[model samples]
Target chain A: MNDASSQDPEQQSMPPLGADHPSVARILRRWRQLSGGRHTRDPDRKTLVACSGGADSVALAIALAQIPSSCVLAHIQHDMRTPEQAEHDRAYVEALAKRLGVDCAFGIAAVSEEPGNLEANAREARYQELARIADEHACPYIATGHHADDQLETLLMHLMRGSGTRGMSGMRPATPLGNKTLLRPLLEIPRNEIETMLRELDIAWCHDQTNDDPAYVRNRIRQDLLPLLRRLDPEIARHASQWSQDLVAMQEVMDERVEATLMEPCTITDSQWRWPRELLQAHPDIMLGYLPGLYCLRVLDNEGADRITRRAIDSWIRSVKSDSNNPTEHRIGPIVAHIRAHEVRFTPAESSELST
Target chain B: MNDASSQDPEQQSMPPLGADHPSVARILRRWRQLSGGRHTRDPDRKTLVACSGGADSVALAIALAQIPSSCVLAHIQHDMRTPEQAEHDRAYVEALAKRLGVDCAFGIAAVSEEPGNLEANAREARYQELARIADEHACPYIATGHHADDQLETLLMHLMRGSGTRGMSGMRPATPLGNKTLLRPLLEIPRNEIETMLRELDIAWCHDQTNDDPAYVRNRIRQDLLPLLRRLDPEIARHASQWSQDLVAMQEVMDERVEATLMEPCTITDSQWRWPRELLQAHPDIMLGYLPGLYCLRVLDNEGADRITRRAIDSWIRSVKSDSNNPTEHRIGPIVAHIRAHEVRFTPAESSELST
Candidate 1:
């Protein structure tokens, strides 16, 4: 028996399926594609199914049961509800894993509920614990159950909030987390299909009534907006998902071009950087295109962009492109921009004696 | 009399405002801004107000009446309706122009409508006729009455059809039409506002019954989807319009970068072109980024992209970026592509022995 993926003699010896359920077979096929054909071939590479006894994750766990892979169960209680409810979820997940003859890992937490970030904080904590447990079990993969409908809602949320292409791009099917990789094999599958499979298999999963409460904007989007949009066009969800994929692909290409442009024209360093005077003078628009990325790379990563305004970038870009020699200064996220005749430069807050 | 503006005594000397209607006065302010501060300043430059006797355009004509500019009425009848209805539209527009004390120009078209494209054909004919009229009058600007609500619908239409950021960017507040500029001053104003202003001024404009007949898809969208969206989020129209504006700004910045990058690493000619092997080898994503643009510039300009499938592009892009040296051929529009190791080249259909 391998340490990472002990071939459980009891589980493997258990009776094989008389016939493959279409849904289970489909999920197994999808997992094969998502895991890059690793799970079944290399039993040494252990798999962790991240389930919270929710319908989607539970259905995912049941589907994975059809496959012969070394797997472990991981669950986390957000502790947002009563302790009784939390224990129910924990016991439910454990019981489900026991029925499948798999080892179960529990991460019960009394996470602090912040005023405006309850959902996000809980999600982050769960992911952190999932990663820790996966590492403990030497599992290289953690599969979640985010599907196409979730993809659609995500796009609408991003659009309504005036997010650029980056935010509009939906989550990747696979994302690397430290040494482990997290995968969602059901992004192309509809939520109804997941529910249908559970019923067909006579499986039961926890249903949290609070998620459907219209207090959350995403709930309204899911309950009302998506349905209304579907009535408008039956393929709305598919179209929205396709659009997300488009943006994701577009961002990849744009990222590459912008990165190359940055490397060619700018002097990048840990503390500060400057763009070529001629690049700014002749092709100012390209430099303008790189401003958001510049903020990400030089000022700070990711969150630095939210601190800058499109209007400021537009103005600076306009002045650079046009016949304007007027000097301008704009303070953006602890950095003061100095725009002059030839080149635009930046000074860090500490060296420039900027107030905190 | 200036050559550009022979102020007809009969029209100019007709009357002074008893008390300028607030609506008319408001439009005069907008015209000043849209015409680049030249409409009121140079009566000599002249302005053509494209009125269809619809409520929105009639309001526009009424507004233009308050300004000191040489304005003329430009009306087009698609002849899709009964002859009587067309004649009524013409006569009604002429009467409105007379009341506003401006010369009227008619572009009565019995345009041959193609099957499945009645609306588009009519529109194309109308624009061509409007361009001719503007050129004949030496009018530098052609003002229309596309309001914010119209912008919202355009975006929704684009979204339903899976449009890129360019299509989602909505209509420009101002676009150049041949020798003249086309301006839509009310894009920031709602359609109901236009109707309200007309009612306040006690002005009556012809309401084409056909427009309300939900037979048209746009009418259904306006009548159904928009109302539903507004119920879901009261600011749907405003948000959609803002999204369009954001995309417009994004395109402006991206256009410059893509153009510069295209110039480098690609050898172009009238008939065929090939990318720099090393550039494609090292930064294959850059080539993928340029694929759409290459189809545009090397094939049929911007609209050429509509003929290509995103999935096909994604597949080719994946194969190109990944560690696969698969030889592939995909015929896109009038070009046949040969994508192989180290290079991707485009050859014209005509010279490539491709049959019609």
Candidate 2:
């Protein structure tokens, strides 16, 4: 018997439903269900797999092929690397796609010589190409094999860069990509799992030499920093992924609060926009969050809304309490909060307004 | 020439005020003026310094002593390391308080044996002791020397531990400690400044050996991690402190939304409660934050609303959307948001209602 049938039927089949190997397939099935079932017109949906032919994406393509789904591979020639190596990578991805009985599409884009916008421009160009392919082929989704490890790396990058909650939340699995959905089914799978799957499938994938170069901050993190973190905790990637999920949930709540605060109706008078002081006082915690914008209004004497400091908010609170008998106005960031006629008023300064 | 004369004349001479130390004296004078120059007999006004005889707290105590107000010092002996060292610390604080002509008090507490609760326990014990001292002296406020560095440390700890916005907010300058207010006047000052002040004042301080010990996670962070971070960016601590202040402001806004979400009236029917599906969907993010407690409500059938999980919340959202037409009551977490005839209704599960 061949290797596929040599093992016990139970072992050779799909393994147990929730087994490690089954997890990838399970996730793919879930993605399909969530996306309202698999596409039928294409039979084997000509998915333009954004494969640099790395272990993660190559493993993804191999596993996907086993699931009786058709896929088409797409490789972007980001001419950032040596011309010889870039061509080699493109050839590898195209050859792999052909071996898997799928058509291949390739695109080349000259990276900008400009310093700051290089990374952003390359990403935009690649995505723009992928979106075009999906539109032309009438494909429902474009799959990218971003694993749990990649998600963790993204999260750590955001944290290191001092990003807000939204940034720290990391990537979503099936966000809208132009007219099509960008499905990242491999996101729940760990990096090691992909490597193991690649080995099991007897697939060879190319590694990008640039990943080892520490000149780029992201490469430094992925190569040096993440290894150190893994040493500290072998499950660091999983933990980071879980943390991102939790933050994503928490961020939703924060976003809602921000919306509610913005949507709350207030009468903008000639002097100030009057809001209930009692209501504000009852939610001191909320006031702390709003203080940054409030500070800009008062300190700059510009009625434009901007971020304020906690100290400014505290000072404003004190002012409101101390000057109860008099009309007291305190600026926090670009917003002003004043007490007049027994009511508190909040307004954005003109200079630091949201428009500016 | 005397040490006082050797110093800059501006630094040596008090501001046009009777208080000591030009800058601190100026602040006090301004505070007094702000208070309408009415000095109330605040016999209960006492400052409890969490002194390890460190430069930071020493400077804080010295500054507080120079104020035209009386204060009592309270020290906590956290017997985590050598008991003898803790005793030495207590003695140093006692002697310093005596030299400054202020009342001194101390409390001894065994460190927590549990791994996870070590820091939490020490903090709880310290505050509990402070409260006891305040009650004994009838003091309405307790002061600690939590400088900017400490705030940064706190923010980093919370961030590393995957805490939400509130956890990342660090310590508040003035928060209620039992019946009394816990104040940190040194929060705005940098650690180096406090050290300089101590040197200038010729005040001797003891350094805690445990601060450098790596057995504790925070100590490891302070000794090894923070230095690396500072090397990467010298202003890391300042930036982190600023970030914490911003988060505090944001948290205030979130607290208000949470309250508003809770206050939205809902009817309870039997074992379940319903809220308007539309309303919940309108503020999905807020609902996500409130999901952990809701999940606990469903699983335990007892709703002592505490923590919620993202998965549990997503599941609830999906179910709500799926069963929108039926309008049947379903348990989410500790609280249930169900669709009703006129509006959405929410109530704690019968079992877990007591916790709320």
Highest lDDT, which number?
Answer: 1
lDDT of 1 by residue, B1-356 (tens): 22122444454444423125665656666766777764356564467888888898888887765442467789887767778887888899999877766778988655554565666766778788888888888888888888877888887676666665456568988787767888887776777778888887787889853354323567768777777666656656665666666556555555655656654657767656777544555643433555555666555654545566655566656655555667776666555666777777777645676543
lDDT of 2: 0.60
TM-score of each: 0.77, 0.68
Which digits, one per residue and each the tens of the lDDT, describe model 2 over residues B64-160? 5553234667777776777788778888999987766567888765666756566666767778877887788766777777777788677656645
Chain A TM-scores, per candidate, are: 0.84, 0.68
Candidate 2 lDDT by residue in tens digits, A1-356: 12112322433545322224564566556446535565543343446677888887776665444433345677877767888888888889888876654567777666657465677767778789888877766666788888788887786566566554345578877678777788887776678887876676566789854244333667766766566555545665665665555556555666555445532644555535555655555454443344344334334453444255446666777655454667776766666666764667666555325443
Per-residue accuracy of model 1 over A1-356 as CA lDDT, tens digit each: 12212444554445423125787667766777777764457454467888878878877787665543557888877666778877888889889887876678988545565555666666677788889899888888888888777888876676666554456577777888768889887777777788887887788889853354334678778777777666666666666666566556556656665666655677756656677555666653533555655666556644555666555666656665666678776666555667777877766645566433
Chain B TM-scores, listed for every candidate in order, come to: 0.83, 0.74
The most accurate candidate by TM-score is: 1
How many clashes (backbone N, Cα, C below 3 Å) per candidate?
A: 0, 51
Q: How far does residue B154 in candidate 1 sit from its true spot (Å)?
A: 2.8
